[model samples]
Target chain A: MDFSSKLLENAVYEMSQLPGIGKRTALRLVLHLLKQPEDQTSRLALALENLRKEIKFCENCHNISDVALCEICSNPRRDKSMVCVVEDIRDVMAIENTSQYKGLYHVLGGKISPMEGVGPQDLTIASLVKKVKLGEIKELIFALSSTMEGDTTNFYIYKQLEGVPVKTSTIARGIAVGDELEYADEVTLGRSILNRIPFENSLKAN
Target chain B: MDFSSKLLENAVYEMSQLPGIGKRTALRLVLHLLKQPEDQTSRLALALENLRKEIKFCENCHNISDVALCEICSNPRRDKSMVCVVEDIRDVMAIENTSQYKGLYHVLGGKISPMEGVGPQDLTIASLVKKVKLGEIKELIFALSSTMEGDTTNFYIYKQLEGVPVKTSTIARGIAVGDELEYADEVTLGRSILNRIPFENSLKAN
Candidate 1:
């Protein structure tokens, strides 16, 4: 006999397609769900359903929202002149969890990757350029990851706003305490070199 | 600001109820769901909703199924005369996963725990005795855990079938190699002693 149920197979297949979930893990998760009260899994299903049916991308920044614009974009309290550009909605949520930033967000959908055929046109870069053309933006902080593709995308965005008065900045990289010096990759090492900070009493003599 | 949306709070509250999931993990999971494409989360919700609406316990074995009797009970090839009683559906699933057991099953829902107010009368033991009275079943296997409640529950089931003409038996116990003997509790140790097997070749010769 076949080793799995049709519904279980279907459910596992769908779950495996999700980010970070593979076939074996998906099967285990499905079995775990089966062990729980049917309501648990049922509620998960309802959340998924509501997410698709009720949520929409914000018209201005393309961030996920249940209304015309996302909460951040719609709110008057958020800094309209300062936009934090990120690769996806995940980055936005990560920043929100920190509770530090009050700026609006622009989700690029994905970073430019030549090998993956994800060019600048594939992202929301053109829309971002159009937004920047309005000249209301005082700053555009690039909170992208410090990978090769991320650098390439950042450089691409930088080139687009060359003549604009907006001040662009990438997140600073610093040496991590307790990190093995031997295990430190060359790029991080190089970035640490470029962004080195001053000692506490070094400027006293000067 | 409180720094948490009402939707985010609701999602976290629901996720916190899951076993092994804590507040921070629940928050992470909720944020991950919120970051996905709206359709993805919606499909997840639909699957959960269908889980409850589509599933029902099998009337015979109490195994979760889409119908009255599970596939095992309704199958003609399985041995109907041999019944294996278990503590829960998870035990039934464990045995079924082995694919070697061809007999029917009786799920007790839980063990007989006086501390927890679970008694034999609350279990499906009466129905099991009724099945035994039909005079067709010849063997009854107890696939219970080796815990105190398991032993007590097994003895209760044994007493309930005083003269039913069925050969009753529990699984064998022995010294599991490389396992910590010091950590082996008294119940397992006593059961192992009760079912000891002669290890020395000289003893067999004698």
Candidate 2:
């Protein structure tokens, strides 16, 4: 049917703008919302308004917060001595769900993609450096993607802390242990060789 | 880390409520919003709010509309006499996307179910029967499921329209050709047999 209603057309246009949601999906969602009671649907509107008017970025970590500092940065129990640097706050959240690491985090705001017009200057790297210079941190983990830009970021960050007396580490690279050798990609094989353990020494010790 | 603000907690909670979206995913969506330029994120919120606020239900068909009548109901080219009945407005939108159907639609709001405390009174069936009784409509299509509740609804609707002149029809039911025998269930087999083609009748007529 011809879409002549301005409200529906606007609603469809707005829903289409969301990531992974298209015009058709947007229409579906809008229709779904319309099926709900006035109270529930209106409350959703209130939530969206509140999200815009009330939510604020943390001044310290650039993570979402209502206050000046984010929860991760302000938590006293979190390990402040070891910091994990990520491309964005989403990465921080992903790592947090794994429950494997206890270190505090620094959200870079984004990777240094010159093609995308994002540079180190555009990120929170300056704040990161200042935090590192505080003399409390002993290690920095580069939890970035394995893209060329990620490598460039790693080298740039390594140079930034050249004489800072801190150990820098990247997450390991290898084929998944049970994965077939034939299925391994070149990058995985290369990283496996570069990070190969001392197999002979371990065998002799055993 | 402990959530320090209700904004963060609320975003996380709301995000988690969406299907397949967890607390971490909500955090990701919120954090992504945090990194965006203020205006872009503001638009997302505005869009959401507009979606909730501006959208209204078409009184005639219950489809979403910006005004009193939805686009479909207002369209002069659409056949007002043929109403495609569906369970939800989302289904209406889905059918609308095909750009093939020209008939008007009747959203049942929900199917009848005794166990769920949903009866004939809970749905828009009464309004539908009234619409049919107006004597303008020529066909009443039962696009409900082929399951037990769908059958019950069809029977109830058929009973309600007794002595009416409009012809009634339903979406077809039968086994899909080329489906593996091993995978075909008893219900499908029975349907296939019941709806068996009359190859012998065609041959004899020739």
Candidate 3:
């Protein structure tokens, strides 16, 4: 689209670089910002700059943090022996929202996706393997998505823990609590049936 | 939603303030930015800040521009006697895209909407009237949306140009070109029927 001002064009170009934002959407957003108070634009810019410049990732879990260790990893009440391994910070946030998992998290940053040219070396796989080899973690929970990349990453990590005595497990693949069985995908339904738990254990909750 | 990092929370909150963006979308955008290289965020922030800090609006037409006078208003080739009055810069851009209009433009900044606490005094109506009173303009085209607020604004401006020796007309309201007659709204179809033009005039080309 032709913009009247170079500044507006530049701003729209930068905004359109964001994921899921197209040229028209970027123009709309830039125009909205132009209509708002100048201070609002300044605040948004400052927040984004500061977030990128000053934000830190936890040394242990690789999750976003204000310090060396993220809140979950630093908390003494969390079960250090039970670590949930996930792809990125969004997964950590999702699990935290559920409030069911009280263990620490190990954010791999991303899955091993060959299509995207992202290998295990590109993620935090080495650090996670080293952590497991240290013998502090007794149970490593694989909480990545049920995709080829997720499975490959999990299997690679499992193989790395060769002689380690830690028990490895994946999150359950089952129909949602309120969802009808007929609506469930065949693969997930089959897996849920094959790995069915005891009738009495199904009723247990934290 | 709870964010583990205060920086992330601040960025997400600021991003969600944009029109049509929600908390979930804001978080997704922020996470995508985090995944990208740091320079991308810095460039986005700098561009937004610079756009707000250094951007200029045309003094005559109130359209966004790099100089005191907008390109359209300063161009000698444009029909200075005919002016299309629009609500905002977006309308100006939309009209420019169509390439059918060869006249100058007057950006009103916004429509007069009492419900939104925006009055005629809040817009650039006074300057527009002043420009018309200068006696250089011979025709004024009202190209605002066919809404209550747009009509009120057009009428208010029309009253301001009383006895100014300028011909006034609104953009035609009818079934859109290449659109089905059955799909046209009742108000538009009714008006199209009542204001039917000469049969031969409908066949005229640009």
Candidate 4:
């Protein structure tokens, strides 16, 4: 689209570089910012710049943090012996929101994806393996997504922990709560049946 | 949702303020930026801040510009005697994209909406009238949207130009190209019928 001002064009171009935003949406967003108060625009700019400049990662888990160790890694109440491994910070947030798990997390930053040129070395997999080799973690939960990349990363890490003495497991797969079983995918449905929980254990949750 | 870093939370909050963006999408965008190179984040922030701080408005038309008078308004090839009045810069860009209009523009910034507490006084109506009184423009095209607010803004501006020597007209409304008559809304269909053009004139185009 033709823009009357170069500044407007530049701003829209930069905004459209974001993951999901397109040119038209970027223009709309930039125009909205133009209509807003200067203070709002300045605040947005400042927040983004400061976030990029000052943001930190947990030295232990590689999740985004404001200090050397993230809150979860620093918390004494969280179970250090039971580490739930995830692909990124979003997974960490999602698992934390469930409020059912009191274990600590080891964020891998991303899963192994050969198509994207991301592999074990590109992520925090080595650090996680070293942490496991320290012999403190008693159990390692593979909480990555059920995609091929997730499975590949989980298997890679599992292979690295072959003789590390930590019991390993994956998160349960089943029909989501409030979802009809008929609508569930075949693989998930099949897995759910094969790994069916005991009746008394299911009744104990709710 | 909780964020491990205060800076990340602030950036997400500011990003979610844009139209159509929500907390989840905001988090995704912020995290995506965090994963990108530092220069990418800095460029986006700098572009937005600079656009807001250094943008200019055309003195003649109130459209966004990088100069005192916008390119279209300052162009010698444009018809200074014919002005297309619009609600905002987006309309100007849309019309420009059609490559059909050769007239100057007068951007009102917004249509008058009483429900939203927007009045004629809040827009660029006064400066537009002043321009009309200068006797340079011989025709005024009301190219605002076909809404109640658009009509109110047009009529209000029309009243302001009472006894002025310029001819006034609104853009024609009709069923869009490739749209079936049966599916067309009643108001637009009825207006299209009543304002039907000569068959020869329609055949002359395309």
- Model 1 lDDT tens row, B1-206: 12224455456666566555666666656566665677666666655556546756678776666678878789999999888887765566555655557899888767898998888897888888888888989877776665678768877878888877887766444434334332345555446434433222212422
The recovered share of true contacts, given per candidate in order, is 0.22, 0.31, 0.87, 0.97
List the candidates ranked by TM-score, beginning with the highest: 4, 3, 2, 1
Q: State TM-scores per candidate.
A: 0.73, 0.77, 0.91, 0.92
DockQ of 4: 0.90
Top candidate by lDDT: 4
Q: What is the C-alpha DockQ of each candidate?
A: 0.23, 0.28, 0.82, 0.90
Write down the lDDT that model 4 would get.
0.86
Q: Estimate how well candidate 2 is docked, as a DockQ score.
A: 0.28
Per-residue lDDT of model 1, residues A1-206, tens digit only: 12223455566666666555666556556667766677777666655455445556788988766667777898999999999999876688888887778989899988999898899988999999899989999999999988899989999999999898898987677557679878898878887888776765436523
Q: How many backbone clashes does candidate 3 have?
A: 0
Candidate structures ordered by DockQ, highest first = 4, 3, 2, 1
lDDT of 2 by residue, A101-202 (tens): 888887787788899998889888888888788888999999998898888888888888878888899977788757998889998998888888788954
Better of 3 and 4 by DockQ: 4
Which residue pairs clash within candidate 3? none
Tell me the spans in candidate 1 whose CA falls farther than 4 Å from its real position.
Answer: A1-17, A21-42, A74-77, A97-99, A114-117, A177-190, A200-206, B1-17, B20-43, B87-94, B110-125, B145-156, B162-164, B173-206
Error of 3 at B21 (Å): 1.0
Docking quality class, candidate 4: high
At residue B22, candidate 2 shows an lDDT of 63
